[model samples]
Every structure is written in C-alpha cells, then in structure tokens.
Target: MKKRNLIGIVLLLVLLLGILPISSLALDEPALNSKKILLIDTASERTLIDRMADARAEPASLTKIMTALVVLDAVDRGTVSLDQNITASAAVLSDMVEDGSTSNIVPGETMSIR
Candidate 1:
C-alpha cells in the first residue's frame, strides 16, 4: 500500500510539472493601443484586424511604402535596371550621416542594385 501511494504521488507530480510549463508557454494575444491599426494578410488580401483603418490619418513613415512601390513600378517598366550601378553622392551621404542611418557604404563608393 505504501509503495502504491508513493508511485501515485510521483506520477501526479510529474504530470503537473509537464502540463504547467506547456500552459505557461501558450502565447497571449497582443494588446494594440494606437489611434489606428490595420493588420492584413498580404497573400489572401484579407483584413485580419482593422481599427479605424478607413479613417484618414497623417501618414508617418508610410511614405516609404509609396516610394518602394514607385521604384518597383519603375523597375517593372524597364525604366530602372536591377544591375545598374549607383554612386553615392556627397549630398546623399551627408543626409544619411545626419539621419544616423546604418550602412557599410562610404561617400563616393559605387554599388550595384541587387
């Protein structure tokens, strides 16, 4: 009877230990606190989460997307080739340095579009 009770206690302890860690590892949904937030599935074109998505708000840092789109369109139209080499201008380098952008490039250095 003593051995049976000991074995049962050991088994219960092991089961709780295993289940507790797994339960704790479960991810909680993120709490987004912003004026407007939009989460979309790019592949499916599905709006997963939309919080005032349609409301016109000042585009801050969103201009990068527009710039990228323009560049991509230009590339597609054969206006800009991917293999084209670009030399870093002094003004551009100065701006990058002032903006504290990280890069291995130096002023006057030439780099090819990848």
Candidate 2:
C-alpha cells in the first residue's frame, strides 16, 4: 500500500512538472503587450524570462543607443509613435547603473518616444 502511494505521488509530481511549463506558455507571452520581454531576479541576480535580453553588440553607447533603436523600431512598426508617452518603470530603471551615464529618465516619469 505504501509503495502504491509513493508511486502515485511520483506520477502526480511528474505530470505537474510536465504540465506547468506548457500552461505558462499558454499565457500569450504573459500578455505584456510588448514585442519582447526580459525579467530578472534582482536578489538572486538570475534571469527569469530571457527573450532577446542578451542581444549582443560591441559596447558603443550600448545603453542609450540600443534604447533609442528599440524605441525607433517600435515607432517604425507602428506599435509606438514619437509622440506617444512611455513611462519608465522601476524594473526598467533597475537595469541601469546608478553611477553610470544615463538618459536621465526617472522612474515613473512619462516621456515621448522621440
């Protein structure tokens, strides 16, 4: 009886482990309403969601220039426009280095895409 219970529990765990990832994928990419997203755990310094987050290039104004280019791409695709306001969230700001050069955008502040 004990052996049967253990087997049942193991099977249940295996089924749940297999189903969880598929169920998460069915969330329509988390409904973020964005073309791509990246999420990291600040405490663990580990990546949670890694979709094009590691886009590679030499570090030539990598931060500001890349940011501008993404905004431009969104503009070109008609998903966002130069006149549209985009608010910088805490998550976005968290990606920045406090002592490093910056675009000077404050968290929660809304600015135009242009």
Candidate 3:
C-alpha cells in the first residue's frame, strides 16, 4: 500500500511539474525591446499591443512584403502560374552582380515560378 502511494505521489509531482511552466507562460507577457512593434488581431481588427507603432522607420527589407502580396495576388488571379518559367534578363543579372548579390541563376537562365 505504501509503495503504491509513493508511485502515485511521484506521478502527481511529474504531472504538476509539466503543467506549471505552461500555465506560467500563458499568464505572462513577453518583454518587447524594439523601437517599433505592432500586434493586431486580423479577425476583429483589434490592436493587442503597440509600441511606437506610428513612428516611420527606414524600410530596408520590408518592401519584400509588398512584393510577396502582389505576387500572391497575381497567382490567385491566374495571371501567373507556379510552373511558369521566368528567364533572368541581362540587366537584372548585371545589376545583381554589381550589387554583390549572390544567385544560383546565370543571365538568360530560366527558372520555375517557385
């Protein structure tokens, strides 16, 4: 009877240990240390958290988001297909090379949409 009670106690402790961290995580909010941050709920159009959200900063790679949206919209409208081939133009290749960007594709090389 005591051995069974000991095993039960151990199992109960293990269960509590596993659950405590997860419950703590659900209760706690993470610390954000960024100049600008925005968290929104798309469903309700609610802003959950915003820190310096209005401040405009230099957008270096953020332009990629617009590019992706446009590409996805085109794909959705059947204007571009995934299997369609795109050839790298000489101007594009030269520009990329001059900018010290690395690419697997050579000039005039054809690649699939993906």
Q: How many steric clashes between backbone atoms does each model show?
A: 0, 0, 0
- Top-TM-score structure, candidate number: 3
* lDDT (Cα, tens digit) per residue for candidate 2, span 14-108: 98888776666664545566445578899999988877656753354756778788888888899987888888898967886666555677789
- Candidate 2 minimal-lDDT segment of 10 residues: 27-36
Which sequence of candidate numbers ranks them by lDDT, best first? 1, 3, 2
In model 3, pairs of residues that clash are: none
Off by over 4 Å in 3: 3-33, 81-114
lDDT for model 1 comes to 0.79
37-90 in candidate 3: lDDT tens per residue? Answer: 889999999999988899977555665677678878889999998778888888
> Which residues of candidate 1, in runs, are more than 4 Å off?
1-10, 17-24, 43-46, 65-114
- Give all candidate RMSDs, comma-separated: 9.8, 15.2, 8.3
TM-scores for every candidate against the unseen true structure: 0.41, 0.42, 0.46
Candidate 1: 10-residue stretch with minimal lDDT:
95-104
lDDT of each: 0.79, 0.76, 0.79
